[model samples]
Target chain A: MYPNNLKYSKEHEWVDLESKKIGITHYAQESLGDVVFVELPEVGAEFEVGDSLGVVESVKAVSDVYSPVSGKVTAVNEALLDNPELINQDPYGEGWIVEMEITGGEEDLLSAEEYERLIKEE
Target chain B: MSQLKRTPLYENHVKAGAKIVDFAGFAMPVQYTGIIEEHNTVRNQAGLFDVSHMGEIEIKGKDAGKFIQKLITNNLEKIEPEKVLYSPVCYEDGGTVDDLLVYCHNWEHFWLVVNASNTEKDLDWFNKHLKDEQVTIENISDNIALLALQGPRAQEILQLLTTFDLNEIRPFRFKSIDIAGVDCLVSRTGYTGEDGFEIYLASDKACFIWETLLEKGKGYGLAPIGLGARDTLRFEAGLPLYGHELSPEITPLEAGLGFFVDLKSEHDFIGRKALEEQRAQGIPRKKVGLEMLERGIPREGYPVQKDGKEIGYITSGSPSPTLGKHLGMALIQSSEAEIGNEVEVIIRNRAVKAQIIKTPFYKKEDK
Candidate 1:
């Protein structure tokens, strides 16, 4: 399901402005197939725009999940440690990776419509 | 660029919604519904594999038997008519050229089924070494299509249509059978480490047999398995693939395939002298099975470390579905290949703890 108000990254990461929570999109999880393991960033780990946050290892290969905006990791989805399949089942909802306090301009992020076009061009 | 080859079931794989990938220069299915699902289906019931990409060579002449005996490591003299033998073709230096299945139809005629990637090279080897002999080595890879029906329930499903008494067929033996009016060579051999059959038929008739087997085997829970599950299953069984465990630089002795090499047969094969010398001196590297005590899975090409230093490398690895543990096969220095020996595998630039274990990681009960 596509969220109208959230900004999205080219790498299929979605961010909600209201809660400042970030997670992978449904399209991203679908393309990656089954999610077996997820390596999450530690709390208080600061990242700049386009920084490597963590990795998501699927059955096929490992993919590096990148940060969309500059922020510090305030909270992480620890449930992924026991149930990585949650990302495949609901990537956009409860599968959110981290809740961060946005420290940079939100204008740098692309709108959901722009991200849809970006994935279409691929 | 070399052109990609397609098997007779290429369109069929596409129609089945398979993820196509280039494997050994052939466009083949890597997965369909899912790897784990297909793998479990084959283990529990039966699965059909499109193996047309494998190379088939027909050797026919008066001295075919003697010629093959000189070329391969196995004791071909023990192989009877209508039986097959699995052996490794070695180089003059005792390094493995390829592991292949040799079928003896009679004294004057034989067939060799080799890995798909080594088709051209194997053909060249046969031609150059035959040395203007009376024997003819024809590359029949394009003309023949192969399918493997593998698992516990394979026999029950296959016996429904064929008139032949499959129960009489012993392991590693084959016979010419008529399936749906098509003449096919059905062999009681497979790579899945299961009681199964590998059926070889004319390329034109492959589709007919494939559809027929699928339809007939539906009651037996037969699924169209892809290459992904095939790899996982074979890996769990501790079977070596060509490019992985057995390479041109690695000998059969080092690869733990010495059982297939008839060293005591008193036959002078091509690599006999080199192999004898190597056997006496002891191999430099030995292939061993590794099981992770740590969390991470050691993948192929990952360096195996000992006391923070590299000693060997992992050849194949995956999470073993049967054992529910991360398992791997590695080629390590002979000095460090002892059982229960502590080792480390570099995963994501970090050395994870592992231990050397015995092979055949998952053994099946006698059916």
Candidate 2:
């Protein structure tokens, strides 16, 4: 279920409204099946709204995780390097991939209701 | 180009919350519950699989055995009725046509279970090779459906549904028995490297048999497995999938299946001359297993390098669910495939360190 407080990208990533934290949505993790490994960007890395931030590897395939908004990465969840299944277990809370200092492109993200509609259409 | 085919258990898979995907032009379940969990279940407890999409060809006639023996690289003379033999049918150039299982009923009757994607092609190839031999090859793919019950607890779970003595069917042997009133050809065979049985029955009875097995084996932790875990299990067991390990471009000998090829036998198989010539001239490449010493996961099509030079590419790779180690199989230059040799696998264009290791990453202790 899409939470009401988070802003989501069309690419199935979510950015927290208050904390500016980024992670994949529950729908994204479910589609990826079992998460075996995840590659996170460094803290100092700067990226545009559509730039790829990292990768999530499953047993069968690999998918790229893209940044939802333009910003500089302030912190990354290092625990995911050892326990990537956390993404599948808890995609919204403890499985958060990175926290960023927002710079621009916040207006492009969809609200929870809008994100829910978008996934249903897909 | 046409609509994808569906097996009899397609609705059952959907009702079980399976993720359906296109496999060999058939709408098949990739997973249900999850891949790693289903994989571990098959290794430890019991798992059921609806493999009805696999192709079945019945060869019947007085020359059936001789005709098949001339087509495959393995010696079938060693096997008798109720025995199963695995072999690779090859092209005259020594390349693989397809690897299949031959279930023998007698010298004049046998069933060939082949890969789904190669059904039409295999039929054409077999017909093309038909000369003066008194053999009639009929494609019975639509008439037969396959179900596999695999794991350490398979026998105990399956025994609950039938009164037949499963112990009488030893490894590589089969029996015609009745399970829940459905007549079935039950074979002590599996691809997961676990103790299991592959049941062949009428296509119409597939869903009934599948449901009965699940209901009866539920107490034993029997879950329906999908194609996702099936690949990982077979890869971990070092069993070759057609497109990856054996193909028209890759031979059984090069794929490290030389034991299945008979080079000195009196029968002149289709590819015997070419395989013998390769043996005499020395095989150029070989399949080897690799374990990652670095972070990146080795994946199929990733370039394998040694001493900064490209040697080969990963054919099949994944994390071994049972062992919890990242492992892969690669076909590399034979000279560079020595055990203990460190190699580099290019992951996302970055070289990651790995080492050659002995294959069959997950082996059952009882075997």
Candidate 3:
């Protein structure tokens, strides 16, 4: 379910406005199959849009989680380090990866309607 | 990106909500419910697999036995009809051409079951070496379909299908029998290191047998497994995948498969000279098992190091679902392959500490 409240990125990541939290989308989790390990960026790490912030490893392969918006890592998801399958079970809620103070790249985000259309075209 | 081939059971996998991926030019299912769960099913209960992508070649003639004697590494003097032999076909330089199973029916006819990806190359190699032998070879891969039922409960599930005494066939032996009304060549052999059978039948009859097995096996806790769990199961069992453990750059002896290589046989096979030479000179590299001492999952192609110098690389690695440990197999220098030797796996530019441990990671308790 693509929620209307969150803005989605072309890389299959979603961002929440009120909580300033970031997480992968449902499509991402489904495509990854099963998440076995998570590598989170250090707290206070600064990065720009398109920079790799963390990593998600599945049973067969590994994928990089890219930053959709430029910001400093305010908080990290410690729970994912122990239980990475949270990303596959609930990618939008408890599966949130990091929280940050939005700095730039706001125009690059797409609405839920536009993101749905983009995935359809893919 | 080219047109991928599909097995006969492709539609069945799609209908069961499987994640399809390209495997050796075939559109194959990589997972069904999940890899870990499916892996567990085969260890604790029973699981079915559509291994139709494997290649089967038939050789029949007066010289069929003698022709294969020069092609494979293992000695066939002790072989009999209805028996299977696992051996590696090598090149002139002692590198691996492929690892395959030879199903011996008699002196005049035999079947070679090879890896799916190596089918074309193996066929070409087999043809190129044909000297004045009376052997006639044919590729029967497309006409046949293979299905494996493997696990602790595999025997119980398969016994309900056929009236033939399944107990009559021993491990590494095959018998032609009627299964659910279809005639099939069933072998009590598998790659999962369990008590199981690999059934070979007509291509058209694959779907019917698949459905019937799943239907009847419902009460026995049988589930459909995919390539993902198939790989993990084989890896945890310490089986060598062709491309990973044995390859064109790797020899069977270096991969720790010296048991299958017969160096003292009177008949000289391909690569025998090189293998003998290597044996005389001492094998330079050895395959060893690595267990992570620090946090991090080792993966294929990762560099292995000792004292800041690159020693070798990981051929295959993953989190063992059955053993619940981060494990890997590496082809490193033989001097550094001793048990309890400390090493490092360079993951993402960081060296993760690991220790050399006894291989196979997991073994089934004796029944």
State which candidate has the highest TM-score.
3
Q: What is the lDDT of residue A13 in candidate 2?
A: 98
As for candidate 1, its clashing pairs are none
lDDT of 2 by residue, B254-350 (tens): 9999999997679889988889988899999999999999998889899999988999999999998888889999999999989999999999889
TM-score rank order: 3, 2, 1
Number of clashing pairs per prediction, in order: 0, 0, 0
TM-score of each: 0.94, 0.98, 0.98
| Candidate 1 lDDT, B1-367, residue by residue in tens | 1377899999999999998889999999988887777888888899999999999999999989888988899899879999999999999999888999999999999999999999999998888789655788999999999999999999998898789999877999999998878999999998887889999999999999999999999988998999888988888888899999998889999999988888997888888889889999988899999999987777889999999988999998887765777889999999999999999999888889999999888777895
- The CAPRI class of candidate 2 is high
Where does the lowest 10-residue lDDT sum fall in candidate 2 chain B? B1-10
DockQ of each: 0.41, 0.87, 0.75
Q: In candidate 3 chain B, what residue range of length 10 has the lowest lDDT sum?
A: B1-10
Could you tell me which 10 consecutive residues in candidate 1 chain A have the lowest summed lDDT? A55-64
lDDT of each: 0.89, 0.94, 0.93
lDDT-superior candidate, 1 or 2: 2
User: In model 1, how large is the Cα lDDT of residue A45?
Assistant: 96
Report residue A1 deviation for candidate 1 (angstroms): 5.4
Q: In model 1, what is the error at residue B293, expressed in angstroms?
A: 1.2
